[model samples]
Target chain A: MAESVSEVRAWVNQRRGEGRTIGLVPTMGFLHDGHLSLVKRAKAAGHAVVMSIFVNPLQFGPGEDYDRYPRDIARDRKLAERTGVDLLFTPSVEEMYPRALQVTLRVGDLANRLCGLSRPGHFDGVATVVAKLFHIVEPDEAFFGEKDYQQLRIIQTMVEDLNLPVKVIGCPTVREADGLAMSSRNRYLSPEERRRAAVLSRALFDAARRCREGTTRAAELVQSVTQQLSSAGLEVEYVSAVREEDLGQVDQIDQPCRLLAAVRVGETRLIDNVALEAGKGMGHVSAYVDR
Target chain B: MAESVSEVRAWVNQRRGEGRTIGLVPTMGFLHDGHLSLVKRAKAAGHAVVMSIFVNPLQFGPGEDYDRYPRDIARDRKLAERTGVDLLFTPSVEEMYPRALQVTLRVGDLANRLCGLSRPGHFDGVATVVAKLFHIVEPDEAFFGEKDYQQLRIIQTMVEDLNLPVKVIGCPTVREADGLAMSSRNRYLSPEERRRAAVLSRALFDAARRCREGTTRAAELVQSVTQQLSSAGLEVEYVSAVREEDLGQVDQIDQPCRLLAAVRVGETRLIDNVALEAGKGMGHVSAYVDR
Candidate 1:
């Protein structure tokens, strides 16, 4: 049966009262193959899958593409039904945030680097809204894509530090053919910009290759990737290497490192990453690594 | 069956899997008769009460009595058992906040007025910790006392604004025979100071008398109470006549007004209030004249 957010919350509570497990897959309303994978994983884990479709305003920065973010509720609903989602919590902006949100959840130093530094207040918004959703959903386990590597790390830190009950399962980064990371924003790129956007993955691969070929310094790898993206006619926002788990700046490839990059192809921004581990005189590369 | 916090959380999740309703009552340990009243209210409302006892450090301002706060774990355990709490989450500060809590919950204008003005960051601390606790407990209904009227209002606003799953229930303020409001801080007062603290209620009652006896201007009532407390040798912090609901400052006593005061007698501080309709003129004086 079609359910409202409150109805699903009631259903979940009733099930919990009887001792049953619930799993949640949080998603923006433009359902694609990536979100379906999360739904499938949640259902297969023997949980009543609840998928929440909310484009959290806090996650979007001023002058960013919040207004243009792709959304298709009718299509998302059909897709959720097809994927066996037991409940779909599609709350309005007003329903999710009835008044101005005064409390903000931030992860300190971790949030001050990488995507957080570039987008300002982005992860704070992500952490706060996700924390609110976790409270509302009260799921035993929550699924997240590894494509948002920094987000995954920040959430893990939040859940651990805050002792939130839900178990965070990091799913593999779903990708398109040509090595492009699948995202709702991928739909916003023009065909020409789409082709140029492939450089995000290519640049990450090239940085990993250099790391494997004894390019140990992070600054060197970042410089090389920046040049490559610029040469590819893409406006590079940031191309840096950092510690794999914490996303902190690294001087050298002393341990596992993530080569992450973001670039704008025309008006569309794209992000991708590859993990590298230092070996004797060389490094080994892992494509689409989970933080 | 008796259970730990983790075990009870798991048990609650299991029931949620099957479908049930859960209620929560958050308390600092040393559960008193007032706390029990809240528990009984929860039980009567058909909620499986999950009571939490953690001396939240964030709520305490620097040099404002965090270390010397009363703690009686064994006694609290016995009280929880007696109150028939379904789950008693007694996490240490380390368990609830493993790392530094940088995020703060601010209630905007509401936080900067009244008790908030005297106790800077006090309600912010309350809001943040409560938001975190709300996430952890994920209760259907959460109960609080109107004794901390500002706190009750803040929590209610947080739940409504954040779209949290929990419903906030405000219970009436429990009090002592001499009319002093019940607070853990009451334990800090010297015997003489404790006795004199009753004057807080006395002064508010006097203000209410003035309001009912044709004194329509709030400033006049506030001035009279301030003089009364000052003459009693107590250092008055603030005495204001404000709106009963939002706690906003009012020029005239047309609506239901609250006469509130806080004073420091020796090293101890006390707060109290009384509600009266401001525009009732002399007819209302008999109803609240004597005690």
Candidate 2:
């Protein structure tokens, strides 16, 4: 049986009491291959798997696409079961937020940068709801995709700072053959916008090519990508090259760096990033090359 | 055997899987008879009790006694054992907040009244920590005292609005013989200040008495208490009678009302309230009566 939040929690507790491990994969439903990849990873890591299907309202701003966020519990349930997920907690909005919330978690400087600047309270909402879900799910290890790099960082920080016993595992971002990052929001893009959106990844790749060819000034690389994205008829939100681990802006890319950008294709906002290393063409990269 | 947070969580999960009930009583580590009463109640309600002893730093304002908050872990552990608590989670600060928090939960208008007014971010800290604790503990039922009436109300609102699965059980306030409300902070009062502080309760009773005796003017009742507290060598912060539930400031005592006041006795801040019925003398006197 696909268990409710309470039932799954009870079962998880029992298994945990007997010294069993449990894993969690949080998704906004409309589970696709990317979500399944996380579920498969959780199941492989040993333990029962739980998938939470909640389109958290806290993470959405007013006038943002919260109301239009895709949700298909029936389909998500079928996908989760196929992927060996032991439990599915598909709670109603009323079930998640029964009253007004007075307490919130703030992460300080990190949140004020990147996607947070544009989304405003976006990361806070993500952090708060994830914290709540962490409590409800109580998994041994929670899986997230590095595709939403900032979000992944924020969750990692929240879990670590809060001393939550769950280990946060970052999974590689799954992408399409055309190199477009897979997101439920991708559905919002018109057919022309969808084809044009691949320019984001191409721009990131072009930036990575420049970095590999010994181009170090982050500002110059970001400017190049901005022009390319603008030329491609996209409204560029931000184009920056930051340190891969901390997500902090860098003036000169001396080590492995992340080339990230957000742009609006038609009316839909799309974000993407790629890791780059000086003198390495994606393959022969060494970890901590800066030191 | 004693358990860590993970171990305890696992145990709780197992018992829950077996269809047993679990309850949580969240408290800072100075376990007194009052906390024990709550534990006893949880046990009597057929719950396997989990007591969380964390002196949350976020809930304390800068220079508002966060450092001076009392703690005795050894004593608390003994008390938990005596109270038959199945698990006790005493996480370190580093464990509780491993990274900076970015999101905060706010209850809007409710948090702006009473103790909230005096200690600005206090309830936000309380609500956040409690919410974090709620997620970590994942209890079927959580116990809170009506002594901190505003806090109880705010927490109830947060739980209800957030759609958290736990049932919030509001327990009655435990009091001292002289009618002073029992609080962990009460220990901070000097022998002289302790005696003088009882005036807070006395003034509340006085206001309730005047209201019951047909004194419908809330301003007059507030003035009397302010004068009485000042004469008692205490600095009165604010004294107001308002609707018990909504906490809206009202002039006439025509409905359920709360006589609330916050005073600084020497350096220690104390808060107290008494419910007043329109024509009855503090009718159906309950220690922590809601409107």
Query: Clash number for every model?
Result: 21, 42
Task: Judge candidate 2 at residue B22 and give its lDDT.
Answer: 92
What digit string (tens of lDDT, one per residue) describes model 1 on residues A1-291?
A: 333557777888787767679999988779877788888888889998889998999899999988888999988989999989988888788767766775556567787877777799898888888887887778999999877888888888777766677899988776677778889999988898888888888787777777777888889888988998999999988887888667888989989788788888888888877776554434434455332
Predicted chain A of model 2: TM-score relative to the true chain A? Answer: 0.93
Please give, for residues B212-268, the per-residue lDDT of candidate 2 as tens digits.
Answer: 888989899999999999999999888888887678899888998877788898888
Would you list the C-alpha lDDT of every candidate in the order shown? 0.78, 0.79
Q: Write the per-residue lDDT of candidate 2 for residues A1-291, one digit (tens) a residue.
A: 433456766877787778878898988988777788889889899878888888989888889988888877777778889899888887777666655465555666678888889888888788777877776677789999877888988788666555465799988777777778888889988899998898888788777878888888999899999999999899999988888667889999997688778899988989988777777655632211111
Residue A200 error for model 2, in Å? 1.5
- Give the distance in Å from residue A19's predicted Cα in candidate 1 to where it truly belongs: 7.4
Q: Say which candidate scores most in DockQ.
A: 1
Candidate 1 stretches with Cα past 4 Å from truth are A1-4, A11-20, A210-216, A280-291, B1-4, B7-23, B30-32, B43-50, B74-89, B102-106, B209-216, B242-245, B253-257, B278-291
